[model samples]
Structures are given as structure tokens and as C-alpha cells.
Target: MSRIGYARVSTIDQDLETQIVKLKAEGCDIIRSEKVSGASRDGRAELATIIDFLRPGDELVVTRLDRLGRDTRDVLNLIYECEQKAAFVTVLDPHVSTRGEMGHIVLTVLGMVAQMERRFIKERQREGIEQAKRQGVYLGGKARLDHQKVKDMHEGGAGASEIARAVGCSRMQIYRILQSNR
Candidate 1:
């Protein structure tokens, strides 16, 4: 049976080295990784590739159940898909495998815990942001495209496509900026 590994992180700023190292150490024949949120199965091309290419008797490995997914239903669905292909799912941490019946129960419990933890993290973040706003210290996210610059360029006869290319942002974002100025 082949050991196929999958690694994921929520954002592009996060590191994937640790997961990759662990997967390599585990002797993964092939490892697919991506920097994308595990909150949804959507837009995760690497993960989709692994699932699509899995062969019967192959083992899909991850460093943790959370790396596979943070949503309980999503995690369960992924496991179900693997099982349907006759492939096994394995999580290194806490060491659960779908090779036996007990593993299914444990994975379900772990998936629920992971989903709960994600909700808790989001709640804490919202509270922190509210506190910052009350203190008048929340300037909000850094502006990717300068509003004044875009406005000036537009007034100077620059078109939406031109401003978007110069500002290194999407044309849709440029259109939004122009609309907000109206």
C-alpha cells in the first residue's frame, strides 16, 4: 500500500515545512500540500488531487486531523470519500487509523473537537477586535490600494483597467473604488 500524505495551512503566511518534514519522515510516497483554509473543501486543489488520484490500498496521511479539516462534517465526509475508494485515512497525532472500526469513532470525536476549537478561536478574535475598536486603536486592515491615489488617477483620465493594473489589484476592486467615490 502506498503512503500518500496531505498537508494544509489556513493562510499563505503560515509555514508548511513542519508538516512536510513529518510526512517525509513517515515515508510518504507522494505528498500534496496547500496554503488554504481548511474551513471548506472548496478551492483546495492539492487536496482534491490527492483524493482523485488515490488507489485502493493507499493510505492518506496527515500530521493531525485538523490539517485535514477543521469542520467536523467536512472531515467526516473526507474520510467517507477515502473509504469509498478503498483507501485508508491516517492521522499521526493521537495516531488514529481507519484500518479498524474503533478508528472511525475516534476520528468523529476528534473532528468535532477540531471544529469546536475553530469556533472558539473566531469568537476570541471577534472579542479582541471589539476591544481594540473601543480603544480607538483599530485602524482596520492595511489598505492594499491607496484610495486617494486611485481617485487622482481616475480624475486624470485613467480608466478602470489602467488603474487596476497600476495599483496591482483586480478590475472589480477598481470598479468598487470608483463607485464609492460617486
Candidate 2:
């Protein structure tokens, strides 16, 4: 059976190098990676591809259980899918696998813990933001588009496509900006 690896990071700024190296050291024959949140299965094209391409006697490997998914239901669903294909999942950290009955139980518990951890993280983030807002120090994410610049460019005889390229935004954004100003 071939050992296939999967690695993921929640944001683009995070590096997958460490996970990749670990997977490679584990002797994974194939590895698929992506920069996307594991909080949900949506927008996870690499994960979908790996699942779809799984063979009957393969091993799906990940550095951590959370790398597969942080949601318990999603993680369980993924494991179930692998079982259906006669493939097993292997998590390096904590060394869990679905090849045995005990492994299945431990993985389920770990999946639940991971989901709870994600919830706790979100709760703490919300509390921190609220505290910062109370202290008048909270500022949301930085704006990527300048409305005034967009307006000026559009008024200066720039086409939607040209304004979009110049502003480093989409043509649809330019159209919306121009339409809003009209």
C-alpha cells in the first residue's frame, strides 16, 4: 500500500514546509498540500482531490489531526470515507491510525477535542476584540481598496479593466465602485 500525505495551513502567510518535511520523512510516496482553513471542508480543493483519488490499500497521512479538519463532524466524515475506500488515516503527532479498533476510538476523541479547541480559540478572539473595542484600540482588518482612488481613476477616462489593473482589484469591483458613485 502506498502512503499518501496531506498538509494544510489556515492562511497564506503560514508555511507548509515543516509539515511537508515531516510527511516526506515518514516516507509518504505522494503529498498534497494547500493553504486554506481546515475549519470547514469548503474551498479545500486539494483535500477533495486526495479523497477522491484514494485507492483501496492506501494510507492517508497528515502531520496532525487538525490538518485534516478542525470540525469533529468533518474529520469523522473524512475518516469514514477513507474506511469506505479500505484506506486508513495516519496522524504523525500522537501517532494515531484507524488500522485498529482502539485507534478509531482515540481518533474520534481527538477529533472532538480539536473541534472544541477551535471553538475556544474563536471565543477568545472575540473576547479580545471586544476588550480592545472597549479600550478604543480596536481597528478592523486593513482596507485593500481605496474608494477615492477608484473614483478618481474612473473619472479620469480609465476603463473598468484598466482601473482594476491599476488599483489591483477585480473589474467587478471597479464596476461596483463606478456604479455606486453614479
Candidate 3:
């Protein structure tokens, strides 16, 4: 059985070295890596690719369960997918690996805990936003640049790359804001 590794981090400033080193020590034959926020569903290309590459008798290794997915549902879904392929999964640092019936039960419990945590965080965030609105305080951060200027730049045929560089933000950030305005 081949040990396949996956590593992820939320931002470009962070490195995947730690995860890579650990996975290598764990005897990973191949390592998939990505720099993307866990909060972003669109940033799971590497994850999808790694899952597809897994096969029977192959072991998917991750530094932590969270490294494999965003939360509980995501973790369970990934585990289920691996099972469907007859693949095994192991979270090295946590010393959790699915080998049989009891392991599945533990995975279920862990998934539920993760789901609950996510729900709690979302509820608190929603409550905070509502409280802020009631108090007439701003809920969102200030825009990086004036909207009219951004519109003018867009109208003048400036690309998102140039606009974002001029505005001191990311191209994806500028694109997302512009797209959401429509």
C-alpha cells in the first residue's frame, strides 16, 4: 500500500513544509499540496484531485482531520468517498486511522463534534452581526478603494490584476466584489 499525503494552508504567507515533512516521515509516496483558505469551497481543487487518485489499498495521510476537510460534513464525505474506493485514511498527528468498525464509529463522533463546532461559530457570528446592526455599527470592513474609481478603472479596460495591484488587494478579491455587484 502506498502512503499518499495531502497538505493545505489558508494563505500564501504560510508554508506546507511542516505537513510535508511529517507526511514524508510517515512514508508518503506522493504528496498533494495547496494554499487555500478552509473557508473557501472553491479552493478544493487539490483535494478533489487527491481523492480521485486514491485507490484500493492506498492510504491517504493527513496531518490532521481538519487538514483533509473544512468541517464535519466535509470530513465524513471525504471518508465515505475513500471507503467507496476501498482506500484507507490516516491522520498522523492525531493518531487516528480508519481500519475497521470501531474506527468508523470514532470518525462519526469526530465528524459530529466538528459539525457542532462549525454551527456554534456560525451562530455566534450571526448574533454578533445582528447586534452590530442594531447598534448602528458597521458589520463589514471598509472597502479597499472607492467604488466609482474601481468602476472607472474597469471601464477604462484595466484588468483585475492591474486594478488589484493599484488597490493593494488580490485579483480574486477585486473580481469577487465586482462580480457580486452585478
Candidate 4:
């Protein structure tokens, strides 16, 4: 089977040397690299191109699983696509290479860990928001227009369209806030 490497960076200023060194050390035949954010949908051109070029029995290698995607879902999807194409994914860091039965076990365990981390983060955020609300502090964003002033204006016969224009927001926003405070 032929082995290939893919490397990526979020921006042009970021270094690709470390990833390249690792891929080269792993004996990659050809390294496909790019500078793009993992969060960006259009940022993974080099990766997509490399996947398209792979044939059956080809191995796709990356420095780490996180380098392959911004989140667990995207990472697993990419891995699944590789498997569907009869290719393999080998992650250099953490030493997980999913090309065989044993590797599948590792992948499953890692996926569970990733999912748990996501859930923990979400729970923590929920707790933080609840705590902030209990403190009676601003738990959310500040109003674009002052609530009291808006109420007074509306009560003073200011048209909804006029308030919206003065506040630099849509008429729906003014009406919604007014309804809420009432």
C-alpha cells in the first residue's frame, strides 16, 4: 500500500514545518499541505484533493486527529469516508492508526472520549450561564437599545418604525422587546 501525508495550518503566518517533519519521518511518499482554518468549510482543499487522489490500499496520514478536523463529527466523517474508499487513516500523535481490527478498537475508544469531552464542555457552559443568571448580572448580551428608554418612547406614542429607525434595529426587535417588558 502506498502511504501519503496531509498537513494543514489555520493561516499563512502559521508554521507547517513541524507537521512536515513528522510526516516525512513517517515515510510519506508525497505530502499535501495547506494553510486554512479547521473551522472553515472551504479551508480543507488540500485534504479533499488528497482524498480524491487516493486509491484502494492507500494510506492517508496526518500529524494528529485534530489536524484532520475541527470537531469529532468532522473527524469521524473523514475517517468513515476513507474507509468507504478502501483507504486507511493513520494518526501520528497518540499512536492511533485505524487500518486494521485493533486500530478500530482504538478509534472507537477515542471517539467515545471525544464525545464525552464535548458533553462536558456543554454542561459546564450551561452551569456557567445558570450561575451568571443567579448572580443577577448580565447573563446574556446587552440590549442594543435601552429597555427603559424604548418603553418610554413607545408609551409616549413613538411609532414602531420610528423606534426601530432610531435604535438601528429592525421593527420586529423593538416590538418583541416591548412585548417582553409588558
Model 2 CA deviation exceeding 4 Å by range: 143-182
lDDT of 2 by residue, 24-96 (tens): 9999999999987899999899999999999999999999999999999999999999999999999999999
Clash statistics: count for each candidate: 0, 0, 0, 0
TM-score of every candidate relative to the true structure: 0.80, 0.81, 0.72, 0.59
Q: How well is each residue in 1-182 modelled by candidate 1, as lDDT tens digits?
A: 89999999886558899999999999999999987789999888999999998889999999999999999999999999999999999999989999999999999999999999999999998999999999999988877679999999999999999998898766777899889989
lDDT of each: 0.93, 0.93, 0.81, 0.80
Q: Tens digits of per-residue lDDT for model 3 on 75-177?
A: 8878889989999888776588888788778777876775677678889989998899999995596554666766679989999999988876667878877
lDDT of 4 by residue, 22-110 (tens): 99999999999987766534647789888788889899998876577656667777888888889999988788887678987786667
lDDT agreement of model 2 with the native:
0.93
* Cα-lDDT of candidate 1: 0.93
Q: How many angstroms is residue 12 displaced in model 1 relative to the true structure, after the best TM-score fit?
A: 1.3
RMSD of each: 4.6, 4.4, 3.8, 10.9
Query: Among all windows of ten consecutive residues in candidate 3, which has the lowest summed lDDT?
Result: 138-147
lDDT of 1 at 117: 99
Name the weakest run of 10 consecutive residues (lDDT summed) in model 4. 35-44
